[model samples]
Target: MKNIQFFFLVLNVLIITSCKGSGIPIDTETDINIEISTGSTVNIKIWNFRIDKDTTLLNFPKTLLGTYHFIKNKVNDFTAFNSKGEKLNIKTIGNKFVIYGSGDLNSITYNVNCSDKTSINLVSSGVIVDKDLIVLNNNILFGDFIGENRNYKVEIKKGTNFNNISNQQVYHKNDSIDIIRFRDYKQMINSPIIYSRISTNDTFFIGSTKFVLSVHSPNSMVKASLLSTILKPVTSAIINKIGFVFKDNYNLTFIYDEGLNEKVYQKIALEHPNSSVYHFFSTPSFINKRDSINYYQDLQQMVAHELFHVFTPINFRDNFDDCFYNDTLKMSPHLWLYEGFVEYYSLKILLDAGIIDKDYFFSKLAEKIYNYSKYVKMGYKISLAEASENIYDKSNLNIFYDRAAVLCFLMDIEVAELSQGKYSLYSVIKQIYKQNNKFNKDSLFFKMNSIAPGIDNFANKYIISDKYPDLSFYLSKAGLSYTMIHKEFGYYFPIKIIAYNSKTQTITIEFQENISPFVKNKQIEITEINNYKVSSYSFSFLYRRYYNQEIAFEIKYIEKGVLQSATIKPILVNVPKIPYYPNIFINRNMNFSQKRIYEKLFEK
Candidate 1:
């Protein structure tokens, strides 16, 4: 979910009065007015508010205390009208609006409209009246404004049903809907509500928190069910280990196309059974085909990846402020700890859960190894820290997820080898959680580094440093080998090729490799290499470094007609041999111990 910002404004006026009970003259009487506006086409719901004012003067909030920015003034398009139907020009100075003189303000009203049409972004609209007075039931989503646990009376213009409303305890009386309570403001913001006719709805009871799944389409039902199922076991595992659970009460909503297929949802369900998934399919001619197996696999992988978030980083962490959502300053150094470590566990969990077979798991691991090899080959290799900091950006998203996954695989194997199969990446994460009071990035790294002595150096060399580390050595340690192949072709020219430099009158014959017997006596002239046009003279210069086998060129010389031409086939040569990892299991080693581990992890 994206971060959102909220704004608040306060108007103040001063008046003098005599205190009857406490004697003496006291500046007691003060009048203040407040208004909030929303510029959204979608109905805006503000279920929490906090405001306090006294007789002496109106004291407004200087800032949304826990929020990172100053947004009081940006809550614009407001007007203060008097009882006589006259407009009152108001100027905002800092947090308070100066209302000239002291007078009893009768009432306050506001009209909040949606200003932007670029899809409903929650934070850009929706303002909780008297935000400071509102008690935060959960964590803050975007800015610092928290939701109050108290009931709120919401009056919407007639004829519009509330769509994507969070915390389902809202009741309708007369023309107003009374919002009863909220689980957490922060969680509410993370779960955005989009209004559409078709949606996937699922309900689950997790202790006191009622988990609701609302998606945009019926096809999302399978995915939602799968997410719910996966999370249930993981959640049960955590509960069994510890006496508590995180994210106690929450709604997991997903918005996607309206016409998505059921098979897509089923694949997602197969992948993630613990998460509440939702989607809206927008197309009608949705077809199921065999080629879609890869697509299903990818979707299931994504579901498992997301559902794992519930326990791994969400519940256990080092620093809260340095979180990716709130503290941008501290996020860079901890990206690897959060994304990389989490990625490692996601794959492990899938393997352990028995969703994938042992051979398939190793094959996936091999693919990671291969991809990491390519990333190393590239000049600009990124460390976990660099990848984390730039992960959200389009340029780094792929590397962050892929490279981190590969590193996790290597590190998992390293841990497994070091502990002689007693400890794995799971142990490392569990240890991190146990050591840190709060689940955060910094603490996780600290714990991980403590267990693995050279972890920092490993991170620096392979992750942070520009120098590429040879992965072949590490991979070979796990009983793997690397290979590279090269091939060459021979050409023969009968006639001596001449290069006439029109600018500098030079003559040269391009170098032709070992001559073939058939064309030895025929006059041949090289005109191009790999489709790149070159003069007969420049062919010698172009042939030296052009090692690729897939080379194409045209040979032009007088034959049957004026300018006869023949196309040359590109030479086919083998490059480096990457490990062939199978995606499915047909023939692979599977023993009792491996089967036991897989069953214990997945419980399937």
Candidate 2:
């Protein structure tokens, strides 16, 4: 089973606009020359700087691959020179450099010594250089400066025999060098580059939207074709559910780490306009062991979350500044919409595609509520909008983003029920985007209300109000009952069966909570039940063989990497052992109105 615990560091992009200075030749294109050496040192040179009336602060990112890996001062020799070769005095503030005292800006040069900083084998978004490969993102390579109408180009001496790959437009200038060009600065920085000696890469199409998976891993079974096969349905689900597809090809660069770093723990998946980079924890060695996508359910969900950004706040944000984070502290107030809507759909698409059952779906939503109360217990109180604006200073709102995701889930069903299945939150969003893609963040709820009718009140109560929501109160509207069941008797099962593999004759099981106190939570195979040898009976018979038994029984499973037999004894306790998510289910008897709404909730 893939680890559900992973971090998604969101480093957004912005297009900065500055007024052009008088008589200055506004550069039509910005050219950068980069040099990469075999041992150390990654050098970058900015060719020209067309000054603007306002300040043009050149900045570099301090963090990237992971939380703690600092890429500070990787470019130590930063210096600017005018056309007359005169040195310009510059004042530094944090990571940004204020460019001042310059005639016609001639060139800026800097050599990067990446080995000097604090990566310490962490899988960060920053640059990584080693014997085998060099991974780079524009956040570390280039400086953020003025933009608009200025084309971007990069000339680099990439090295011999190293397979060069990127999401941007790449053209070869022989075996030793390559060039990449973008329409603007935003496009250029959004593209990531990977140079490796050997890799497994392939291309597949989902409804004419080409996807290329370029993988660099030491594991033999981590094939691009196999990954493409595993992720195809996930890709298709997002495309079909949203009713939109990318017209151009998109890149999925998959890179792996074998060192003693925490790369496997990072769970890194950074999104760009035309591509994304997925840094998997561990060796990515599960494909040969189990090829089913259900085995990697969290991966499936996380991939969907990243892909949904293409539609939400990413493409739909009003202006340039709204889309990009000009600084670390400045964040959009509509982050709740971005994270909540995207996360809920990640689960919805899977359920819609039958990849997961409703039991698992409701359980996940319940888990979110259970987790949020922990924060509430600690005296944390803030509305969704307030939490977003104060994300950095106060508690991180994204950490408890489920508070918002639950809101989106409620909004989704309300919209569906209100429209009598004529519309949903997803459809209304797309509909709004169809009319206008540039809706500002401040007016997001306004558009949602205009299209859905009742969302204005819904937003007022759940989003703007800091009152802790009674999820059961909302679930009741759809003919659903939410209850917290205490410890009873007799049903102490060790595994949660999510899916059955008929071909392999194995049941995909998840250990959610309290079943296995000693073992870690994961989906492992139940190879044998009692003495029946699970493969002998149908999927349903596992119940009679285990659930109804009052006596002791023996079951075999992989215990500490070995198949071992263990005896299971039933326990009946009046006291609850640990906190668990409340149970949610549809009521058998409901009023006609609620029954109709529930039917629309699960409408085919």
Candidate 3:
């Protein structure tokens, strides 16, 4: 009876083996198949080889992104199993694991125990595989990680329904999961997919290259339309004037955060024009339903700034060494060319487009100048070139942007003067663009020397060398001057107040501190600045101007219910100032002759 039972068991095993598909054997030559599930589990299938002679291991990378300097190897929670479903012995080798095969094994399988329920957070850039390494080259502003000659394949898991992804093949299995595939690393790095519930439409262009907007936020359509309309003309102008022949295509993407308000979006859009892609987050604090006009205007400015990158350093980089790299942090030294020139054009494009009047443009320039003065006073001023080289240091990032713009303004004036009212920085850039080659620090230096041999020394001393130039001297050459104004004895009061509403039409005293006897029982109202009746609603505007300055104010204070008047002077407060062209319209008119000269040099 026992022999009969054994025979039956062997016969059943043979039948089960026949029913299975072509299975992988151990201790034979074959390829390995790894199946990674979204649930954080991995299945390994071996073919034609025996499991007894093969080993499997799972591991993690040693470094994270951005920091770039730190390196460490640590991995855990790994296990292996055999065809019989028996657990195998495992040993750790740094971040990897070593598994012992039963005998001449041809197949193996292992599982990686991850704590996260989703696989999104596990995705990373800058991967190192054994002797192979992958790095994204950042020298060309719009360049991608994959080179033109290389080709590879990537397959994303399905069922996670991430939508509106461009330049990628996506497969959907359900609402929560999807799979994406890329032909190579270049495609993956150059194209960044933003997944959000908010939906919006956008317009994009680089010469004949047109992009339709794909956003998740529904409320962003209007703003996206505005951006599309504004950028169309500007991009057309750039392409018409300068043909696109380089490998880098200036590809960029804009991602709007439905939670971000108009003001914050405007700030980000204006500031980060050259970013490969901008993700604008809309939070409760940034957007409000009541201020649609302001919101629209802010969106226009954001679009203008972002689109401007196509013409500036993005297309006309300073040189190869100045380019960005993953391993090192450095700044580009051609701030006068990059930011300053870009700022000048951003304003010019808006003016030429008739989006803003001449007066508004000049007012903005004045604001910049006032802001520049604060940085100058702080003894932290540097030339545009120096600022560019040190820009990514984080310790001085903020100062570089504003300061570089100021230097560009000065250089524009210098170019205008040198060419006898005939040439400007615009002409110089156009010349470089016509050359149709990548820029490097050495090439830029050589070009500057070629244009104005003596100017190189001047640049070395005032712009390139490690010293702050006397900005006042340069402004004087352009018939401008910087003066410090003081007001300390006009009238005295101990209260700080502001109007509660525009309807009030009158300033209201809000707080009093260390009250003086002369104004203790007095009701005071601000009526004028330098004899102009101060609009109560415009008090905030005035405050912005007087951020670090003391000024004389004509006040109407009520002493015991009786109206009184006094002129009070407050101490000057120190604040940072950005350089501005106080008379941009006049400057443009005066410099119009230079445009003709530039036309002569490059127009033909």
Candidate 4:
């Protein structure tokens, strides 16, 4: 997900005896009622919200990704009136419209309908309407917010046809409607409404926090229960590592793309405090599409990343840009903390859970270092602090993700060593979560330093200065090593096998060139991968589910009718002919200090 695409709303929630949202007012509540009607396709027939304050203008959802067509495609029949039931005239501005006369505008109403000429977007979200399902960004649909900081008392009038509406935070008022209260406008807008003729639901819990998984897909194989089976254990491990920041119910909306709309990029998941929505493309629509070793691994990583977001700026935030969050032009310099830290924790927690191995972890770390080098070579030589500020300038969003991961991975190690292994990055995160403090841009790092000293210096180098240090030194803290292979890169086996001969009960695979010192032949993967027998998995599953990572396997061959397995702990090496990043690996021999640090990799 693009950090820029996170032109998200921040409803600074206040907690008693806590430091969060100290200066922000969140007590005010707006009363809203929505009635949605649909036929061949989903449509918001008529919706009205009551904003008590006198207001002359209305705004559609706005975020930093640029102008959204919410006003043009999802809104119409807009009208406003006071308590007297008098009609009010409104004039269109640029992306917003103005109420002709200023009064205590108690009521505003609108309906969603795409003009015959306007194009609709389903793949990349905000607002989408499909034949079997309808997913609408509530903020994009319910346009007016009296105050950006106010909470909401929302009532969605659902007819009998709304039986398939997303099942989270629902308080049914009868057979026709459901009532729910949001802590802030941010929660209401970011929490989308999903309805599908073909849908399924699964609910899970970690601690007191409840989560409901709702799926809307044409593919019968894409079921909420199936995904829950894949996601629950990993999620439990993550939340177990870093306790759930909030004790509330959340909905995870997973929408599968059946090529019903134009394909955009890949999977897109937007995170919120209480809910998150995902758009799946290239994901296995059918569970049997991938080998047992990697069933939904791609989706697993993506969900883990999005899930970790709850701990970042959501609970731990720099409230400098509050009201400007949606369709915002303002950018925060804390993208490193917002995304970088989350990415680090996501991957680490996944590793802790065995959802991913150390080989994958080390590969990702090296890849980030390589990515940082590429950007530096391209004249994008700036610290994450600067890049985050100018994220839209040189399009350094990707750089932040790469550089930030590199920075945090190293920082986690450095932090561990600095405190004599007392506090890792997650330690700093948990302390921040407990304090419930909102950081200021200038003092964010200093505040982190107070939590775990030396953070400010780390920030000065990787975030505040244009200095990318020797990553090898940091990896060494935990008995790890890094290096690069200069070779050509090729396709990885999605099935992790090429051809299988059931008659012989044997498997065969091919490689363009041998890049690793461990594996010598061009086509020699004769036996096992990650300890799983190669013959057990399907030889041919079509879509690409896994990406650029070294595989750990063994080259087992039959010699004189005796099964012989090579000693090489293997990773397929299809290195690009061009220069690449360092590869991280576990060092078998380590000093006492290195062993202590390495043992703490999963300390908490």
TM-score per candidate, chains pooled: 0.53, 0.74, 0.54, 0.71
- Name model 4 segments beyond 4 Å from true: 1-55, 64-93, 104-125, 144-161, 164-167, 171-184, 260-263, 282-292, 321-329, 486-582, 602-604
For candidate 1, lDDT tens digit of each residue in 1-604?
1112243322222223333344454442222333333322112112111122111121233222112222232333334444454544455544344432113333233333332212222122223221111111111212222211222122222223334324344445433223232233333333332333344456776566566665444333234565456455443333333334544455555544321222232221101112333332222211122213333444445555655555544555445432122222323445454556556566566665555556555666556655666766676555666655544444665564567676665565555545444566667667766766475443444466687654555556655665555555444334443443233433223234544432232223332332322143354343333333332223233332233333434444433335445654423223332223323222234354443333333233
lDDT of each: 0.40, 0.62, 0.43, 0.59
- Local accuracy of candidate 3 as per-residue lDDT tens digits, 145-223: 1112223222222112234423334455446444444343334343443343334556566655655544333343335
Query: Residue 238 CA error for candidate 2 (Å)?
Result: 0.8
Among these predictions, the greatest TM-score belongs to: 2
Ranking by TM-score: 2, 4, 3, 1
Winner on TM-score between 2 and 3 is 2
Q: Could you tell which candidate, 2 or 3, scores higher by lDDT?
A: 2
- 2 or 4, greater by TM-score: 2
Residues 64-83 of candidate 2: C-alpha lDDT, one tens digit per residue: 31122334556667888777
Q: Write the per-residue lDDT of candidate 4 for residues 437-461, one digit (tens) a residue.
A: 6766787677679977877887788
Regions of model 1 farther than 4 Å from truth: 1-180, 183-188, 194-196, 204-211, 218-250, 258-286, 289-296, 322-332, 359-374, 390-393, 439-444, 464-469, 480-604
Tell me model 2's lDDT, rounded to 2 decimals.
0.62
Q: In terms of lDDT, which candidate is stronger, 1 or 4?
A: 4
TM-score of candidate 4 to 2 decimals: 0.71
Kindly report which residue stretches of model 2 are placed more than 4 angstroms away from their true locations once superposed. 1-41, 47-75, 83-85, 113-124, 259-266, 284-295, 318-329, 484-582
